[model samples]
Target: MLKRYKKYSFLFQELVHRDFTKKYKRTALGIGWSVLSPLLQLLVMKIMLTKFFATGIEHYTTFLFAGNIVFNYYNESTSSGMTALAENSAIISKVNVPKYMFVFSKNISSLISFLLTVVVFFVLAALDGIEFTWKITMLIFPIVCLVLFNIGLGLVLSACYTFFRDLQYLYSIFTFLLMYMSAVFYDISAYSDFAQKLFLLNPIYLFIRYFRKIVMEQTIPTIWFHLLMILDVCIVMIGGFYMYKKYNHDFLYYF
Candidate 1:
């Protein structure tokens, strides 16, 4: 894959550039919107949920940031990625290129947006009185795993979407429900042990929990926690890649 990426580096870069062009072109704030958008969402969510849910969590705002950032990245990446092949149907039908290139570029754009706000998250954490640790460095592990996880899942979704346009509507609803399932503001300690384990079944929740454990709790997650996150990535990536290989040709028909 690295060799393929190197072979097609120029096209990949252009796809990324085009994504930025389409998203920020003629906008006043330009890239500044990347930072501001998530903060605005954080503001809205905090306003709505803090009173009811912030009761016991220390540094509730920071906790909210942790969930909002991770979930939004997943949302944006997969949403754009769902249309990767279809959006570039012109280019794909006319030229021979790796379809995954479009999806990768889309994910990269979403990742850039997420990283900008990560800077704000750190600054906010400092002001909110959360102590930092070297474990903060390990936060990148979950971020990296999440990028791969998104790509894998993006592959599956884009494949499915080519054949079923209604998937787009269904996905919006799923993500809406996913926001709450991710425990963006709620503390899940109130749940029974079995229910607690069920929350870990959600890969997004696992990543959010990782951030919370590091940023708010100032601790590293156990080995099992890391493995579980990786396991989720592996399963999803394998499934996505397989789905694409099987259906790549069929995508042309639906497009």
Candidate 2:
């Protein structure tokens, strides 16, 4: 498995480049559009929410940036991952490469886009006068954990999608709900105790909230937060790998 992962690792970078290039090849603006989408969303949300959210939390724009960056990548990967195997049917059938490669490639593509947007967010945060600290260095750990979590998620979801076409529809609806539940636009503390506990149980929420604490508040999350995230990553990656190993051969038949 390690050899297989390394063998096609080069393809990961190439696939990511292909996806990024094709997205803006003919456009006058080119890659600027990738920077534009998230920036525009941030502007619209800032305007629209000012009237309602009003006073703002401590470093609220930074808070939203943290949540938006991570959540957007998760949304893109899992949603596209639903068809990761099925969409690559012709290549998978003709080649002997690992089935997980197709799914992993889609995620690497999204990760490239996400990194581009992160630059925009960093610049905007500086312009908005949000403070940057050495604490910003802490972002590295959470990001690595988030990537591992997403890879596991994409692998498992891609596998299930092979067996259940309905998973495509289900994944769409779930992403919509997951976005709101992630507390992207509001503080989780606004919810009742039971609701907050439920949110804490959600590993995605944990990841987003941890980022928010580091970037927005310039502080680490509580000890339990790190503990929970570590546990969640372990379970998801292990379970996802097992499922992928067991049924990956079936993916070709579905495609």
Query: TM-score winner among the candidates?
Result: 1
Against the true structure, what is each candidate's TM-score? 0.98, 0.91
Candidate 1 vs. true structure, TM-score: 0.98
Clashing pairs in 2: none
lDDT by residue (1-255, candidate 2, tens digit) is: 788778887876676677668768999998887788887887788788756653647667767777777888888877776577888788889988887777777877777788888788788778767777998887777778877788888888888888888988888898889888888777867678998999988888888887777666779877788888888888878988899888867777777
Top-lDDT structure, candidate number: 1
> TM-score of model 2 relative to the true fold?
0.91
In candidate 2, how many Å is residue 213 off?
Answer: 1.2
* Candidate 2 local Cα displacement, residue 29, angstroms: 2.5
- Any runs in candidate 2 off by more than 4 Å, and if so which? none
Q: In candidate 1, what are the lDDT values of residues 47-104, reduced to their tens digit?
A: 9998999988889999999999999999999999999989999999999889999999
RMSD of each: 0.9, 1.9
Candidate 2 positional error at 198, Å: 2.4
